[model samples]
Target: MKLSTIALTIMLGLSSSTMAQPKDITIRLVETSDVHGSFFPYNFITRKAKSGSMARVYTLIEELRKKNGKENIYLLDNGDILQGQPISYYYNYVAHEKTNIAASVLNYMGYDAATVGNHDIETGHEVYDKWFKELNFPILGANVIDTKTNKPYILPYYTIRKGNGIKVCVIGMLTPAIPNWLKESIWSGLRFEEMVSCARRTMTEVKAKEKPDVIVGLFHSGWDGGIKTATYDEDASKKVAQEVPGFDVVFFGHDHTPHNSVVKNVSGKDVICLDPANNAQRIAMATLTLRPKTVKGKRRYTLAKATGELVDVKELKADEAFLKHFQSEIDDVKTWSEQVIGKFENTIYTKDSYFGNSAFNDLILDLELEITKADIAFNAPLLFNSSIKAGPVTIADMFNLYKYENNLCTMRLTGKEIRKHLEMSYDLWCNTMKSPDDYLLLLSDTQNDAQRLGFKNFSFNFDSAAGIDYEVDVTKPDGEKVRILRMSNGEPFDENKWYTVAVNSYRANGGGELLTKGAGIPRDSLKSRIVWESPKDQRYYLMEEIKKAGVMNPQPHNNWKFVPEEWTVPAATRDRKLLFGE
Candidate 1:
């Protein structure tokens, strides 16, 4: 019989036993990860679709509480709660002057504990520190430690005694990749221990010191592969099962894949692991039954099999009262989004290439170049949203496009840095440009260089604009030959010149390990010094910008080309069979 089937049968048979009867002690873990500060149900794109909203999630949590009683439940956020949507920006910046609505809503929801995600660090330490003070729940992470202070920045682990007096040890763990991905400044003093080691150390400590009956891992680290082989994260969870000796259940997050499976550890014992995807769309439910006993002279417990499912929110009734309050926030955001700030005579489009030029990308570069009046400009193409249709765009549209709420900032880059940037782009495309058959356009071919570029140079210039052109030479490796030919103005770009480029404040400050390091360029992009008269809402600006361009029709601009310097013609590079001969 399948493990789940057998486990279920065992539980059913033991259901009404005097010793196994359902005790007053029940534990329900409701988790939401990678919410990214989406408190309002605003699309920020079409401003139509009902998504990225915490109101609905809040309603669902309320319903769960009603059905399962709050005294027996714990609401936990798996992390990445601080970034993603514009409300994060609204709360971090605009609402900095007021109480953060996102925090208010989460606090109101009564979260018991949470772990951090890498994106949460993007908010910078000061902001995070300030906001953390407002949280009622203990933020847990055994791995994230301050090198200078020699203490974990967040609570490493804590134990909770549930209603029926079941002492459960909850250990939180954040991914160790935080330092490698976030801006250097934000993570300067932070050091992450390997996930498995951290879990082992903490769980061993808890077992020896506290000896909780049920040990639950509120792991913010993700499950890397299927349940069998150890992905660094899986090693951590499985190790907890084997080394720690008493782990009953593990709740996972960060990777956003939903799964509930039993992982057999080195000792050939089983541990239950659960992960439900992000955005508050689903909840992971694991029901456990335990029979308390005194073995010899010590209290021992019998733990049941771990079985779970991703509870679908669509099937639940939304809390209407909560929805009404969240709806008001949405309405305010919408009203703020509708006001037009600029106009355009032509329709300007962004590029749609998985790996080529985009008019949508052009607008962002244009804005960067124009704002700084730089000789050349750069920004990541993935940052943009889906292409807009013809008509008046709104602030909501801009927010949707730049969904991450990356503030604008300016940075100076030297000619050499510029060349390095373009070369990196080429390297990115070359890595994935495997044309086994020249006739077949590989579906894996993508447009943005940064997507595949291994190098982390090239700072941001956030002046989003309407017209720009450039070609990248992708053939050469980093350091010498990669080139950028300016296409926006159809001019032979000067290589020896320095340009002031505007970019999102995050990138300007070297978020994503941008070229700010050792580039010798002065950063004038500090939040206080930068002048931003535009409201937090961007839909109006997007509409205004599009209107100025008029009659939007984007043409192929391969003029900015990247030919490989060291070209390798693969053995399978022969032309493929064409369905309709071209």
Candidate 2:
């Protein structure tokens, strides 16, 4: 053979070998955040089948797995899955077992990894510690560190491999505000670090050590405005995506808002951030395309395209097999929730609480004062429009009345501080009416939407004070709205006089900035102000109160009202009709 022909033959053989290499692959990541224990199609509170549930999400997951292939998909949960409905509460407290129903369901669903949420911590170590150990997949939280070892209390992150030569790393972080809303005893021996600093440090370490192809962030915090300072970084997912360079995709929860968008990172590259909302309404889907490349005689993969979007599971069918597996537990919880504990002589509704003193809210205040022996009590309607018809009261009714697992806390506050707290609460609850035609309550376009007419602020934070005669003047500005008359026992109100006040642990720990901002109490000093605290959840105490009372009658204390009823009543009436309809 000729020399030129031999060289050409060798070149052709090398080219053919390169062309026979395996093609590039694609991987899909599916995530659910803030499931909040809505596993079944049923709404345990209303006792009706709801549109959003984990059962529906399972169907969506099965479809994606089949389409993309099981090995090419990653299934993750972003936390807040241990509390909310009767089923979770039953497994958490009522039934003492080796594994919880929430853990069982997630394990059976084949979750690749998960994270811990604030609510999951609210279940205390007894519940979450056990549930964490029972899970098959790794539950991560890099920011939750043990004080003794000064290391991560849980698995910080998990690294998994997909089709040939591709490695994906998922790092998890939770909001550092756990100390602000929970007592020290609940989260003892562990400290939650600020998310931005934690994320930056963790990502740097993971990139150096793992050197994976793609980095996914599973954050249990939400994306708020551009506030990234340590003290005010409750929701820092947006800041992390914008400031951190290694993250390719970020998933967030804890705010209960659905979002899917791209933000610029430190390197000026676009990074996808997604939130699937709460109650299993939607699932976040991120699709990444990888292509093989040969550099310096080494084969590697490069991420070509990355996109994130929320997929609604409302129209999807429930996974029948999964539901059938837990049918017996579901039925037992339903039976326990329906067991009658007491009787109400008259029906009370939550709508009345927005206007002034209402039987619905006062009933809770009465329970707090009775149990704590405090001079005054403060509470708000946790549910927006829940009501209990006169006659039979069941465990379900207790859940509707007190939605959270907050413990009852009694704190010492002076009269001046109490007045200031009420001013802040009413400022968020009502508006300064320029005239009768103006709206009494602050309602935004989103609140007035055709689907729902809710308040701009969470109605649960619109607190009302009992055991004192007061008036809220809507004509005045925020700080000057409250006017205290006298105590419920007929003593003149004194700003300097100290009094024992009963509030939920959420407020006592400054969850809504009520105690810190309104009462002028430092956030760090909140725990010192607690005079007494209930052993169990406030709802448990309320249940015991109802059983002791036997025949319950929910009545308003009528200690406070909105001034200028001529202007306030008429405006509130019109707005209520517009907001709630008749």
Candidate 3:
């Protein structure tokens, strides 16, 4: 049995537990997923953030180990642990020339095994290879195979023997959707097989070879109600529980939502599956008790008792020692925050649902217009939180509000394409005609797409600012909601007019498909047009501009109306009249 990091810490106590007819060693599986390289207690830019720090998690892990002997514990990270903020980028691409904070922290903390997530490939495979080599424990992913070697670089499954001599075979699998969203270069020669097939084959092999006491699947794919399809779904955890035999406890990820439920499969067997929320904001601890159970013909041990908790980091104090050690790194982020990169003239805030001349959307629009050098440009309205208070804004504020780290791209659009884009927005409202009461209606329809485009942080809500006048008829299909009223300069939009539009690369690459299906100027992909600006820096400047222009108005413009334009045979759209019912 390999001695885990915790076990190595208290070797003397571990020996006693080892010598005595080892009692059932309670394996404290501490899982942190989608950490995105948040190791320090303070935000790199803010220098004062208290929540979602890796050091705090480290403190808890240490405390947990002191309470529960090493042989009784293991830590696992369910992918998306690499990319997100500037620090990870700085380390992976610039400063340290490495991206293995996960490996370093896990090495120090003694994580037993982990699975890869989608964002891990964002910095490219070279970084992954460099960092992966430094891991003391196995970074398991049976699904991630290198075509060059035709073998799994990371360990697929690991059999961990608890202090009581009870062996548990844990298999790790990354999300099969990696190739779909990741850059081609990172996963160029790689392939993500179906999750079902991966789970089936790996579990079968582990059952035959290891034949351990309990089977655990540390999966990076999310639970999608296990809908048997080309890939997995939310129920995937349950589906694996039902379909994949020999697995008792399953830890899932990628959704970044918390789900602590014990679901049973069709075989009259129950398995506990848990998904810890992202950002190390929450830690999931699952306690499993190994007990004997009978199969068809033989007696075997199985995971009998399973219970878990989502330990909020807010409840834990910041580990001052760890902060002191990483002080330089933390200070570097603060410096990055204070650097003035750009500026704006005055505030341009708005209240309309689509196009506004508000401080937030106006800045985005101005950037889009300036970058694209277009006569008119459009932007998505993001409404994550209420307006920034009358004070200085920070980078953390930008990241929190404009969570997506999207690449900048520009494109050429025709009048037809512009209409199509507006139509898409109209369709969004039309679809929610009946459910106008749902505050998060647009977010629900667009979150997955936005997240894929790394536009989670770029999200805006409430008012929309447009360069053209548009009317939406809720009675029509989604495509015909908005009627072009006029253009920004009060010029009538010519359907044949060619226009250049600046947007993030994600949007250009059919992010929301806002410009994809249009009978207009064929989009010309401009790779280096829109510069990726720092959210924090932008927000800080925005605060200054807001103060300069004390009184602001984000008034509503209900001038646009949705008249049925698509369906000749009008079908019941959202089963409602007003887009936003009074």
Greater-lDDT candidate between 1 and 3 = 3
Backbone collision tally, model 3 = 45
Clashes of each: 47, 0, 45
TM-score per prediction, in order, is 0.72, 0.94, 0.73
For all candidates in order, the CA lDDT equals 0.57, 0.88, 0.60
List model 1 lDDT by residue over 27-123, tens digit each: 5666676676656555554665555356667776777678877766777777778776555655676567655665677787888787777777667
Q: Judged by lDDT relative to the true structure, which candidate is superior, 1 or 2?
A: 2
Deviation from truth (RMSD, Å), model 3: 9.8
Better of 2 and 3 by lDDT: 2
Model 3 TM-score on a 0 to 1 scale: 0.73
Question: Which residue window of length 10 is worst by lDDT in model 2?
Answer: 445-454
- How far residue 544's Cα lies from its native spot in candidate 2, in Å, is 0.9
After TM-score superposition, what is the CA distance of residue 189 in candidate 1 from its true location, in Å?
Answer: 5.2
Q: After the best TM-score superposition of candidate 2, give how far the Cα of residue 582 lies from its true spot, in angstroms.
A: 3.3
- Whole-model lDDT for model 2 versus the true structure? 0.88
Off by over 4 Å in 1: 1-26, 51-53, 58-63, 66-69, 184-189, 225-246, 295-300, 314-316, 344-355, 383-385, 407-582
